[model samples]
Target: MRDAGESPLLVAADTFRAAAIEQLETWASRLDIPIVSGRPDGDPAAVVFDAINAANARGNSTVIADTAGRLHTKGHLMDELGKIVRVTGRAREGAPDEVLLVLDGTAGQNAIQQARQFTKDANVTGLVITKLDGTAKGGAVFAIVHELGLPVKYLGVGEKADDLVPMDARAFVDALLPRAA
Candidate 1:
C-alpha cells in the first residue's frame, strides 16, 4: 500500500498461531510501517477493532488486519472468521472493503475446494496465489476464478514483501504458457 501512496497500518490479529505476531512485527519493522497488536492469546477481533480506532486517530488511509490462517474444513475456525468480520463492521461501517483469500499455487484441485468453502464462509472478494516462484504453475487460479467469479488481485511471486505484484492477465498467461522462441 505504501508503494501506492496510501498510508497503511498493519494489525496483527492472528493471535492463535505461535510467532504470528512476531512475524508480522518483523515485516512492519523492516518496512518502517506502523502496526497495532494485542497481548499474546488476546482476542483477534478486539485487536482489529483497536487497529481501526488507531487508524482513525492517526489519519491512516488503510488498515490491513491479518487474521489467523484457518483451514476451511474447520467449522469452529470458520465461525471465528465470521466473528472477526462482524466485529470489523462494528468498528467501522462498510469496512473491510476487500476480503482476500491466499492460496498455495500448488494446491491444484484442493485449492478449488478451499476457495469454495472460504468464499461461502467469508465472502472472499479476491484471491492471492502464493508459492508461484517454485514449480507451481497456479493453474487452479483459472478454475477458482471461474467457479467463484472473483478476480485475483495479486500474485505472491516470492517471500519478500515486495514480491507481491498486481495481477496482469497477459503477463500471467505468458508466464504460465510461454511462447516459442
Candidate 2:
C-alpha cells in the first residue's frame, strides 16, 4: 500500500503478492494482466524450487525473488538472489528463463548494497526506484544509472499506476538541469 504523505508503495513481499493477485483476478472481469501466485512458506529453498516448477507448469515464468528484510541481510540476499537466477536459468525448455527482483531503493546502504551485489554478476534487466518524488537524495539517480551499470526503468512518481513514466534519457536530462527556455 502507499504510505501516507509519500508516493511509493510501502509494501512487504506478502502484501505485494496479495495486491498482484487481486489485480490479476480483477482483470478477468475488467481488462487485467494474467496473474498467479503460490505462497512459498518463507523458505528460501522452497521458494526457489516452486519458482522453477511454476515456470515449468506454464512454459514461461516471471519470478520475483525476495527475502525477509530482517533475516536475509544485505549480503545474504544478494548471494541467494544469484542462486535464484542460476536455478531459473538452468530450467528445461518449459520453465522460465527470466526473473526480475525488485529492491527497496530508499532503504539506505543495505538495499543499495543488495542490489549492487545481485547485479554485479547476474543479469538484471532494469531497476525500478520507488518514492522518486519524495527522496531527499533523488539526485542519486546519477550514481544508480552511471555507477551501478543498470538502467532506471520505472520511477514511482506518484501513488497511482499511471503516475509512472518511462525515463527518457534526453527528457530526463533536460528536466534535471536548469534551462534557459
Estimate the Cα RMSD of every predicted model relative to the unseen true structure: 1.1, 7.9
Q: Over the stretch 1-181, how does candidate 2's per-residue lDDT look in tens digits?
A: 1223322111112322335434434532342322333343344444555655654576532444443333234566556556645655564453333333345546655555555655674566676666656643345556655777677776667766576666676766665675996
List model 1 lDDT by residue over 1-181, tens digit each: 7768999999999998999999999999999999998778999889999999999999999999899898889999998888888888898899778899999999899999999998888889999999989999999899999989989999999999889989999999999999999
Range of the 10 consecutive residues with the lowest summed lDDT in candidate 1:
79-88
Name the candidate that leads on TM-score: 1
TM-score of each: 0.96, 0.58
List the global CA lDDT of all models.
0.91, 0.50
**Model 2 accuracy (lDDT, Cα):** 0.50
Cα distance off (Å), candidate 2, residue 113: 3.9
Residue pairs with backbone overlap in model 2: 27-32
